[model samples]
Structures are given as C-alpha cells and as structure tokens.
Target chain A: MRYIASAVFVIGVFVIVTAVTTQHAAKLDPYMYDYMIENFEDDTHAKNAVAAILLDYRMYDTMFEALILLTAIIGMKQFLPGAADLRARDELESVDQTEATGEQSSERPSE
Target chain B: MSGPVSDTMPTDESIVLQMVVGLLYPFMLLFGFYVILNGHYTPGGGFQGGSVLASLFVARYVVYPVDDTDTETLHSIQRVFLALIVIAPSAVLFTGVIARNPEFRSLYLTTMDVLIGVQVGFGLGVAVLRFAFFQGVGKTWHL
Candidate 1:
C-alpha cells in the first residue's frame, strides 16, 4: 500500500511537471540568455557570464547559498551521536535524581 | 535525516592502496584549488571549486574513516568563513556605493567566490564527519 501510494505520488508529480513545462511555458524566457550574454562583459566586468551572474549580479543568492550550506552542515552535525551525548547524559542523570527523590519522571530536568 | 549511523571506515591494512590513495589526495586538492583560483577567467566558479574542495574530505573519509578534525575546530573555521562570505559582499557593495570605485565591483565578485569556496569546503567536511562518527543527535547547534 505504501509503495502504491508513493508510485502514484511520483506519477502525479511527473504529470504536473510535464504539464507545466509545455512548449509555450518553456519558451517564455528564450531571448533572456542573448540579452545576458550581450551585456555580460560590459556590466559585470568578468570574462565569464556564469561567474558574473553567480558571483556579482545575483550576489544575494551567493549569501543565501552559504546560508543553505551552513544549514545543511549544522543539520548533519546535530544528528551525530556525539553531538547529543551531553544532553542525553544530563537527562539520564536528572532521571536518576528524580527516582531517588520519588518524584515523577514527567517533570523536566531543571538542573 | 536522523538515521542509524553506520561504521563505514575500513579496518583492513593495505599498504599499497593506502599509499596510492594518500598520494592522489594532495593532487586532487591542488586541482580543486586551481579550479577556484581560475573561476572567473575560465569555466569554474565557487560551487564547482567548492565541491572539488569538499570532495577531498569525502575522499579522505572513503580511504580512512578515522581521519577527521575535531568538531569544535571545524565549527570555528566554518563560522569564520560564514561570516566572511556573508560580510564581504556587503563591504564591497559599500565600497562601490560610497567610494564609487569601479574596480571594487569585479573585486566583490571574485572575493565572494573565494569566500564561498572556503565556507563550502569546511561545511561539507563537518557534515561528513558527523556522518562518519556517531556521538548522538541533539536538537541544538553547538556552533
């Protein structure tokens, strides 16, 4: 059942993508590339248009790109077992103290 | 994304293989740096060079799993790059606008490319380290 659901979902995505990228929609920005290439050296000062667009014209995107990479790095670090040991140890210690005091384990670890 | 971490480090001792891989590692890193350095004049740029640099860490991890830096130091280095990547553009823009220096415009682009390369390289290294070593998962960030 899960596999069937996933297959249907994927098929739906493919159909949606195909419909959205039809001939007219795909050709909307056809001349934009020519314009960019023409203005590349004059406005950007760099020999490469890819570099100009990526590094200068759309620089804000580069900053966001850094943010995205940092977020992914931080996300992966958070999942590492060593990263959580300190908090887990603290929680376990609090649980042990709660048991000794005959208090409910449901209570948060204040210490 | 949090799943059971697998021990992927090789425990075997292959002297020939290790030596060959070790030799290739430095050269690959040099090539990655070259890609970054020649980004504007050539075809490569920040992401391309950044991925090249990141692949060094990935390659080292593949060869020897135990070879990784401490997370604290990695975190500090990444933070520094992150700050620079974020701040340098603003500084350049300020120079371009305030000082009205035309040269700073191109400098701004090249500068960001270099900063992005460093930030991305270490960011991936940390991510790879986290995957290779399983200390546990926490909801908060240390860096």
Candidate 2:
C-alpha cells in the first residue's frame, strides 16, 4: 500500500512537472546571455563568463544557494539520530547538567 | 554506548583500499584547491571544487575509520566561511570598492570563490561524518 501510494505520488509529480515545463515554460531571452558573454570580462574582471555571472552579476542566487546548504546542515543536525550530540561541548555544558557527561548515547530513552 | 560519542570513521583492514586512498587523498585536495583558485579562468568553481574536497573526507572514512575529524571545529569553521561568503561580496558590491579600483574585481572574485569553497567543503565533510556516526548507532529513534 505504501509503495503504491509513493508510486502514485511520484507519477503525479512527474506528470505535473512535465506538463508545466512543456506547456508553460518561459522562453529563453538571448539578451542576457549575449550581454554576459560580451561584457563579463570588462565588468567583472573575470575571464570566465559563467563565473562572472555567478559571483558578480547574479550573486544573490549564489548566496541563497549557500544559505540553503547551511539550512540542510542545520536540518540534518536537528533531525538525525544523534542530533543532540551535534552541539558543541561548551554549549551542551551550559544547557544541561547531566548531558554534560560528554558522552553521546543514541539509545537513551526519551524524557 | 553503541554509537560513537565523537566523529569516527568506520575502517577495515583492506590494504588495497588503504594504499589507493593514501596515494589519492593529497592529489584530490590539490585538485580541489586548483579548481577553486582557477574558477574565474577555468570551467570549475566553488561548488564543484567544494564537492571534490568533501569527497576526500568520504574517501578517508572508507579507507580507515577513526576519530580524525573534529566535527565541532568543522561546524564552527563552516559558519565562519558562510559569513565571509556573504560579507565579502556585499561589502565590495555596496561600498563601490570594486569600482574605485577595477583591478580589485578579479581578486574579489577569487576571494569569494575560496570562501564559498571552504564553506561547502567543511559543511559536506561534517554532514557525511555525522551521518556515518549516526548510522554507527545501529538503532533509530521512534519519534
């Protein structure tokens, strides 16, 4: 039952993405591409046009990409089996007296 | 007690794996740095270089499992790198520093690439090691 549900969900997503991309996809504008290729070196002082776009022209996107990476790390630290143990020793010490033992036991019963 | 209290790699006594990784680790690191440093001039950049470097940690874990990594330190360093990644560009972009000295633009690009590379490399290394440690626990939480 779970497999069937997952399969249905996956197929639905695939169909939706395919439909959206094929029918409603935005057309590419060649202006930005031409501008970046022609002016990136002079504007950004980088030899690579792609690098110039990523680091200079479209920097905010890269910043958000880094933030997303950090968020993933944070999320994993919070939800993983030994999540509590990911905290720094000093932080743990300040927060709890018993957990300061500095030993991580994944099998510890829930409080 | 079954799970590692600290970051630990799982190891085996396979000589071939150990020998091959021992030979390959340093080169991978060198290549990762090369890719990051030459990002503006070459096809590679921060994300690609960072993943390459992170693969070194994963390779090391496969070769010899041990407590070689300090997760807390990596975590702290990654945070710092992320801050620098944000601040470096913002400082230059907003303050018109790059405009004042056009020669500084390339330098800024390289610096941003390095900061991003470090952030990504450390972030992934910490994640993989922590996941390995989590798996070592041999049990899962119900909640």
Candidate 3:
C-alpha cells in the first residue's frame, strides 16, 4: 500500500511539471530575440546583444543575483562558530580583571 | 596590561603607523562599491564588490594591532553585517515563490551576485583575522 501511494505521488508531480513546461513553451515568442537585436544599437549603446539584454532589459534580475551572493555569506556566518564568541569572551575577561584590580586597590588601605 | 608587555605595547611609533594604515580604508571600501555598482556593465560585479568591502577589515588589522583595536567589538559588527548578507537574498527568493513564478530563473543571478559579494567579503575578512590572530596555527584561543 505504501509503495502504491508513493508511486502515485511521484506520477502526479511529474504530470504537473510537464503540463507547466508545455504551457510555457507555447507562449514563448522566438521573434522577440530578433526584435531586441535590431533595436540594441539605438537604446543602450552596448555592443554585445547579450550585455544589452542583461544590463538594460533584465537589470532587476542582475540586482537579485547580487543579493543571492549576500545571502550565502549570512548563512555561513550563522552556521559557523568562527572566532566571534572567542573575541567576546576575551573582552569580558579583561573587564572583569580591571574591576577586580580596582576593588583591591580601594581596600588596600582599609585592610 | 602591566608595564606594557612587548606583545601588548602600543608603541609611539605604532600610533603614527596606525593612522597611516587607517587612511587607506575608505579608498578600499569605495573601490569595492565601484566594482559592485558597475558589475552589470564591467568585468566585475557584486561578488567582487562584496570582497572589496570585506577587505576593509583586513586593512584595519594590518594597520593596527588587534589588541589595540578591540577585536571583540569588531566581531559583533561583523556578525550584523553578515546577517544582512544572508537575509537579503532569502527575501528575494521568497518573493519569487510567493509570486508563483516557477520559471523565474532571472532571480537566481541577482541572488547569486549579492550573496557572492557578501561571502567573498566576510569570508576573506574572517579568514584573514583567523589566520593572523591564530598565527596560522590550528591552536584555538579561549579568549
């Protein structure tokens, strides 16, 4: 029974993905590339069509891609212990030592 | 802290040395941003920019001794900036899912650029600090 259920779930996902891809394929216009290439000179002044496409037409995409790089850094910092905690403890120790010295100096005459 | 151990001493010369070292930080930071902003048109992009930004820490270390500059406080600031690096890209990715655009392939590039910049910067900074403070040995300091 479990095998049958698993098989059915897999099949259902496959069908959904296939349907979506087919729908997208139908909507794609091949001629749009030619149109972009023809107008590339007048608008962006970029020599490479690919550069024009990326920087001008798809600038937003480029921005988000940069964000992805940022996220990875964050993730690494979170997951890795690194030297952050060690550095913090060192500061606390120094502070504690200073306070202890101050207390001893004040009490020296009284004792 | 007593009588200035040679290791802990901030010599008079070191002060002048630190000031000179500090002068170069802004330029390094600005260059990183320049690389990031022009990445779309030029050879470098966010990854390079992030690295350039992170290099500022290294510049600081080289100019001033770690003991003189309070490494502990700097670590906290590093954590906050690193967190921003992680959260920003995730937010972008989450937007794509909410919008239900499975074919939103363009989102990948933006996220990649930002995260790479952050990773390069943070990674380089941390690596430099770790190696420097630890003296390239695997021994861990208890702080």
lDDT of 2 by residue, B27-124 (tens): 99999999999999999999989999999988977766653467768988888888988898889976888988898888898998899999999999
For model 1 the TM-score comes to 0.71
**Candidate 2 lDDT, tens digit per residue, A39-72?**
9889998988889999988999999999999999
Candidate 1: Cα lDDT at B123: 79
Per-residue lDDT of model 3, residues B1-143, tens digit only: 34323343334335666777678777887888777655545667665787788778766655544433333444455455556545654564445552354344344444444545655566566555655665312222221
Best by DockQ: 1
* lDDT, residue A58, candidate 3: 64
Q: Global CA lDDT of candidate 3, please?
A: 0.57
Q: For residues A1-111, write the lDDT of model 3, one tens digit per residue.
A: 999999999999999999999888765686988889898645554444654565456656755554464454456546554455655766677768877777655644453
Error of 2 at A1 (Å): 16
**If you score just chain A, what TM-score does every candidate get?**
0.52, 0.52, 0.51
lDDT of 1 by residue, B1-143 (tens): 45553343354535676787789988988888887877787899778888888888767655565533577687778889889877776776644762466666667667777877878877777776676555433322111
Report the poorest 10 consecutive residues by lDDT, candidate 3 chain A. A65-74
Quality of candidate 2 docking, DockQ: 0.42
User: Interface Cα RMSD for candidate 3?
Assistant: 7.5
**Clashing pairs in model 2?**
B9-B65, B11-B65
CAPRI classification of candidate 2: acceptable
Q: After superposition, how far is residue B89 of candidate 1 from its true place, in Å?
A: 1.2
